[model samples]
Target: MVTPGSPRGIDVKIGIVDYEAGNLKSVETALRYLHADYFISSDPSVLKKGDKIIFPGVGEARSAMRILSERGLDQFIKDFFKSGKPLLGICLGCQIVLKSSEENSTYCLGLVPGVSREFSVEMGLKIPHMGWNQVSIKGSHYIFRDIPDNGSFYFVHSFYPELDKSSQVIGSTEYGIEFSSAFSVDNLVALQFHPEKSGPFGLKILDNFIKGAD
Candidate 1:
């Protein structure tokens, strides 16, 4: 398995999206530790130059979208998707890419045909669902390369995206009901968990993502 260093596959101009989203520091630290070159940019033009974009967000859905809109990052992301460049969205980043979110009845980027909803407290499930959980890998996705099918990762969120059977659910974890833990379709992928905070296994996931960016 390849370690988190120079991709050894492709040299990616990595750009991390800065939309006032929390957990950016952890993500940036991981990349730095991985020896990957990256920059945190709020400017669309600077981001457009990136070969791969990382949208690791952790904030309220409505306000996050509003920030994206106000900064004109909404269209920038859309155009980036259309450009077929690789994008990795995490946590709130994952939610904002979906069709809609129950959090404040917010409409999202609609890249993934799914909805982000809160885990019901009535189901005896804890709100936020914070903690480490095992994720069952669906297929032989590049993102899962060097990572076990049932690896544990750190998660800290109340809501998750509900994907259809045919949805690009590369990794799944059962909280109360089965929910998508990670989604990968073509060049775009999103994760509900925080790989940066997930230790060595998380590093492997990020390494795989970088290698697969080509």
Candidate 2:
């Protein structure tokens, strides 16, 4: 469990995984605002040097997976997760951790046991669920300890993670349907929304992860 602490980015080195995915700079921008020490890299070796890892991604799953494979980051992420350190997933980072994505039937890292599914068109919502939405906390997870129960966060995705174990879910949100917006397993904390783009509350989430969640 995470305890109360000041921002520890000076002590904690964060690694933001880069695989040519979008939104890398925005995440970096957030870390910078928090005065966190971080580096963006595609090299597995450099990423392994980080005390904490932030996997943020955007764009199609197929191409993302392809880039990860080409750079051998696919196996590196799997290995890193087993190390049991603090790892945060944002947006595509949340979806790609699953076994596969419905987007082109692309196989993912399978770090979490589930699949990413597209929102139903019949729901009459936009294909990409953009803009702000409220995320309801499921339990007392440290990642959301400082965040309000139903805080609004920025989101820009059509696919959502449907985990096999509901016990792992830490947060949920409603689009056309209720879905897993955030989940945690061991040291991994993942959110389908873009916390970096969500303003103060979002920065708090990052601060919580960086300073407290170990």
Candidate 3:
């Protein structure tokens, strides 16, 4: 039997928040391949067993915020972050974790002091900024640990985080302009790229996350 308040003797239970987001299946698939035990749930009680949380999204900002509010998950996430558990937010999930988003002027979780803005169409770059791009590791982050200093990850979004505190930006990539590609602030970490679709390099990142599930 496992000791209470110590490391639980079970497969790492990862909670994938089902908040009407996108690319959740790929997240699950990556975790499964890492031999992690996880479940997708909107219920806070069900998520109580999870050692870590993954909030991935592929949807409009306003609608996504509305859905999270309707499900009472907006506050849930805020409170959960206080517990100091490892929380990973991807793409739209990354946006909503900030104070506000330019996308429809949506207010988000305020977990990070930042704003999400869209890439200017006049910049002669792709609108969505989709496909693999090199991510320059600016500093040490738990998720990026043990990965190549220079690596590429899959990205598929137009909006990117503009952090109020530049120190939180641990990873960055160039598109039309250099934007905050990833952030790590204590227990909360968010990435604009899709590590699930990033192949071996991506998998290695996920593997590091799994190992850090303690």
Q: Name the top lDDT candidate.
A: 2
Q: Quickly count the clashes in candidate 2.
A: 0
Q: Please rank every candidate by TM-score, starting with the best.
A: 1, 2, 3
* Cα lDDT of model 2 by residue, 60-91, tens digit: 99999999999999998999999998889899
Q: Give the TM-scores of the predictions, in the order they appear.
A: 0.95, 0.95, 0.92
- What lDDT is obtained when candidate 3 is compared to the true structure? 0.85
Q: Which runs in model 1 stand beyond 4 Å of their true positions?
A: 1-7
Local distance difference test scores for all models = 0.87, 0.90, 0.85
lDDT of 1 by residue, 68-165 (tens): 99999999998898899899999999888899999999999988788998999999987889999999998788878778878899999988998754
- Assess the local accuracy of residue 171 in candidate 2 as a C-alpha lDDT between 0 and 100: 98
Off by over 4 Å in 3: 1-11
Q: What is the lDDT of residue 146 in candidate 1?
A: 75
Minimum summed lDDT over a 10-residue window in model 3 is located at 1-10
Question: What lDDT tens digits, residue by residue, belong to model 3 across residues 1-214?
Answer: 1111322235577899998687988998887776677899998777767888899999899999999898888887887799898888988988899999999999989999989999998998878999989999987776887677768899999899999999999899999899988998888889899988898888777766766733
Candidate 2 structure, TM-score to reference: 0.95
